[model samples]
Target: MTTRIDRASAGLPPAAPVRAVHLGLGGFHRSHQAWYTAASPEWGIAAYTFRNTELPRALEQQEGAYTLLVPGAPEATEAIGSISRAHPGADRASWSRDLACPDVAVLTLTVTEAAYAAPERDADSATGRLLAGLRERFRTSGAPIALVPCDNVPDNGAVLRSVLRAATRDDLRFSGWLEEQVSIASTVVDRITPAPTPRDVREVLDTTGLRDEAPVVAEPFSEWLISGDFPAGRPPWELRGARFVDDVGVYQQRKLWFLNGAHTLLAYAGLARGHRTVREAVGDDVLVEMVQAWWQTASRHIPIDAAELAEYRRRLIERFAAPGLRHELAQIAEGGSQKIPARWLPVLRAERAAGRLPEPLVRGLAAWVAHLRVGEVRDPRAAELVGSARAADPVRRTLSALGPDAGADDELVSAVGAELATLAKAGN
Candidate 1:
């Protein structure tokens, strides 16, 4: 079952000193972003996982090469030659040490919503980890690296800057130091990427006959919209259908509203309905209708026109329905508290402000809060979070416990509470 890489599968690896450095080197980043880089052999990317040694061990053993499969009924792996090295994030000594090298120009991050999560700016939860990471990158060495945050937070570059500013310890010199160097770029990345399961590994092995210890599998569709500057340069991803626009906000709004917002809906409602994967949930007629209804309302407000929105919607439906993509309910549920504010709150706030409260969106929010009551899922890293949960009103309880934003008036709170009560009594 151990097959040497098909030399024809991926072209010759590009010449030395890796051009890009990726953080949070999980399966999704491999299948999605790395796949983009692999399409062009020139941009050899050396990536690292966040504090996980196994990824480094796997990559180095393979000589910085692995299989990336486009997930489907019959999975197929394409040999990738982009990665030249891998390391663990906690090994910041090496992590920081690598960034200083002049060859590394672009840095991409896929550290999940929790990394950039600040549910409410006013709350004590906000910190400038991304900012600090960049400032430190500059402080360690004045090497100009493009800080591309692949995480999906609103105005992500701005958020990155704000956090770095916040973490400067109220020190003007440090703030000045930050302002002088570093180009914190923002990007909106899309792909129906799911964590690989044993079944997935089996398929990759069976079809490709490649003994890939760490293969990344995702659906065919993918996108990356970069809004910030790439001072030190970046991958020519646009050649392979990526759009490098002046403002990715319109695109982001279209996506964040339907794609991500719909995901939140399915995660909670789909879980309640006994559907496990996002694909499974969207497949059910009842749930699909709910998704459609929710999207119709939200899409109307998207910055894009009707024709473009319609096409995006169509593409979204097809992407969600990708049977090969096993986007887990639990993975979607990972940082509910962290993600709720950025993806869900804006829609809720806009609707309420317009005097039209979106019931489905409210249901999605309630379902997430209801998940807190179950306690079957455990995020050990988030041990500090679960302990502090409290509630006066169910709405107040959920928001208050979330560590940010008491959000709107009593009317909205009651609406959320009523929905939560319905969900609780419905016993899903």
Candidate 2:
């Protein structure tokens, strides 16, 4: 008997190239980056998950292919031609052998924001994993490649080196080889593809009954901005509408402030108002206002203009309202400890340094902290910061978990604590 997934293949297509190898195989990778890579005939990316090999195992059984459904005004459909190869990254000993391929130009990463920091961080951080492989290439094959990080950090390439090469500080030769052979690029990736629902499962299956392991459902919008260096080489992602800039920080800020920042607002406030999905929360005028307030407070500092921000919010509302997409607040709010410092507090610091604390932003911070206290919240980063998050001193706790700079001012900490007190009982 065919499973529900296998029995529902209506419009699936064949596989594409296998030039690219991805480290973190998640839904976002399939929906956003892989979709773009599939659009081009020359670029084929192989993906690997961490220890959970369900994605790779399923797709490989289907010959390294999958589907991407765009939930839009009419809901568009197409067979992606992007991924052609995939495996698990925990198979590191063997997988590292494949990295020796000179043509595999971009080693792209979408590992969650939490994974950015070095374990037990200090002046000397973790960069050995990167150094070891690149060093092998320099010594044996003289091949070079670009190490691209597709996460949401400020300077992702810089962070990757700081953690990967600087972690131990024991090997100078490996560090020198990494400097000579490797190129770390920062990329801003954007797309709002939600997790698959039962309806989506049914929608993907047709008369063909073809099952896919990693079918992605998303909004029609997508964007990617790459910077740093593409030493080995890169595909012409520009052909498919990707922007290549020298300073991806501007683009990163654009996506982070508008897309991710707004996502946090909808996740925290929207849920408090009894919304499960972003669409349901944003559809309500009240929840919409909350997000608007968030954007307004954050808008004061982003590089873009108010008009542009307004336009972005309008599109975001439309995407949220689309019943076809079912983005989960639980998922968005999963990494508060990891994301708050880099995503929310940066704007907070910016706004505060200029002498004005945005009320809505402050409210958001409070809500997130309170949510952590509720004990039902499923934030993994919260688990990582268990001790600090529970402390009576909100600023001390927040700064300790988030970073050193997060607790700079007593007034700011107290204000966040006060707002959190108001919203403590609320849950959406």
State, as a TM-score between 0 and 1, how close model 2 is to the true structure: 0.87
Tens digit of per-residue lDDT, candidate 1, span 309-412: 88888888888887677888878877776676767677667787798878787778677667766644444334443433323455665666453454446776
Per-residue lDDT of model 2, residues 327-402, tens digit only: 9887787777767766777788887788876777767777676667654566565564555567667545865566
lDDT score of residue 117 within candidate 1: 49
Give residue 117's error in model 2 in angstroms: 3.7
For candidate 2, the clash count comes to 18
Model 1 quality (TM-score): 0.87
lDDT of 1 at 109: 76
Worst ten in a row by lDDT for model 1 = 119-128
lDDT of each: 0.71, 0.70
Give candidate 2 regions above 4 Å deviation. Answer: 1-17, 72-75, 119-132, 164-172, 207-209, 384-396, 403-408, 425-428
Error of 2 at 107 (Å): 1.2
Query: What does the lDDT come to for candidate 2?
Result: 0.70
